[model samples]
Target: MDQETLPPNKRELLKQISSPHNPKEESLGSSSHKPSPKPFWSPLSLQMSIQEYELLKEDDEQCLRKYRKQCMREMHERLSFGPRFNGVHELDSGEAFLEVIEKEHRLTVVVVHIYKAGVKGCEVLDRCLDCLAAQYPSVKFCRINAAVSGAGEHFSDNVLPAVLVYKAGEMLGNFLAITQHFSDEFLATDVEAFLTEYGLLPEKDFRAAGDEADVE
Candidate 1:
């Protein structure tokens, strides 16, 4: 019988055996796989010269200095309130209140009222401050207990209900005995007007988007 008349499997085996074998193909399919070529090495990659090392060291120092300066700028931005102040916050201790005046006052206008307990004048001002705090979120309003605020005896007698204003860590205005200016029956508007006269409280924000930056 002719090879073409043989079964398909036998025909294929005979054809492969009669064909010339390829050594390159056999090696490609061998048991062990070939490893990749090694990369060329440059002297600069292996070891640095003394001058190069010094230059690298200088570059590292300069980079470190820039990083430190960036961190400090971020810290200043966080403290400076590039944004304005929020609502009122009560200080837990005298130290905390002083810290705010020393560190945080630089950011925005700080209004601190030293109040004594059981004083009708202080209570009236406190209510006024609550109203203003809601209206003017940009100004910081705080109240401290005169007795517990480490203020000397002088504050207890004379400066009860005193409103101290600060901007940029400097005392701008000190209004003592606010009751002398207005009676306890005064409303929030009265207190606002008084503070506005001293440039403590800004005008009411009537812009459409109150939180947006005002365009020039």
Candidate 2:
């Protein structure tokens, strides 16, 4: 009985059975269900061999010796201002790093140091670093290698190439600076907020970012 198909109801049933609702069908679901890329500032271990470690240790000693030889009074600097992130510390099992949580909260600043392979870390590096040294020095500033780790977990690749401040073992929670680009006022606000939280500064009227830009 081929009268332009057996009947309307029968034809519709055949179509429904042959073309079932397919998950693979387009526009049937949310586009944003895909996972986000990890933060770019994820912790990474700086790779080095035993000999390299020895060399660094020896070199640091030599620098101290030179400082001693050159001056009658020892002039000091914050050479290792923040937690040493040679990868060993940042990637340690959760238990081992718990000590940091208890340690008095100092500003733990992580600078997502980015440099093209074969590039030198010099003046230009300092230019970008103004937000750190001038704006957020009260925090202990450390650095991490960004190019090596770009996975998009909040602390990994998603913000790749980001500068983050952590305090009391929580990322972003105790932070003042979380990005590479910031205006002076924005930086000042966060720093002031952090300093207040730590009771390092008074309750009001602090100097702001680039206050010295005009002088220099």
Q: Which candidate is the best by lDDT?
A: 1
Q: Return the TM-score for candidate 2, rounded to 2 decimals.
A: 0.26
Candidate 2 Cα outliers beyond 4 Å, as residue runs = 1-126, 147-159, 173-216
Q: Report backbone clashes per prediction.
A: 0, 19
Put down candidate 2 lDDT per residue, 117-194, tens digits, no spaces: 333332243344455344444344433343333422344333333434356566543332233344433444554454
How do the residues 1-216 of candidate 1 rate in per-residue lDDT, one tens digit apiece?
Answer: 699799999987887788676546665785445678877866776566666888999999978866776676466446545455455777767897788788873556788988888866888888889888877666788888887677657586556789998877899889988878886589888998899988887656332123243332
Model 2 worst lDDT window (10 residues): 201-210
Span of 10 residues, lowest total lDDT, candidate 1: 207-216
lDDT agreement with native, every candidate: 0.75, 0.42
Which pairs clash in the backbone of model 1?
none
| Per-candidate alpha-carbon RMSD to the true structure | 17.2, 32.4
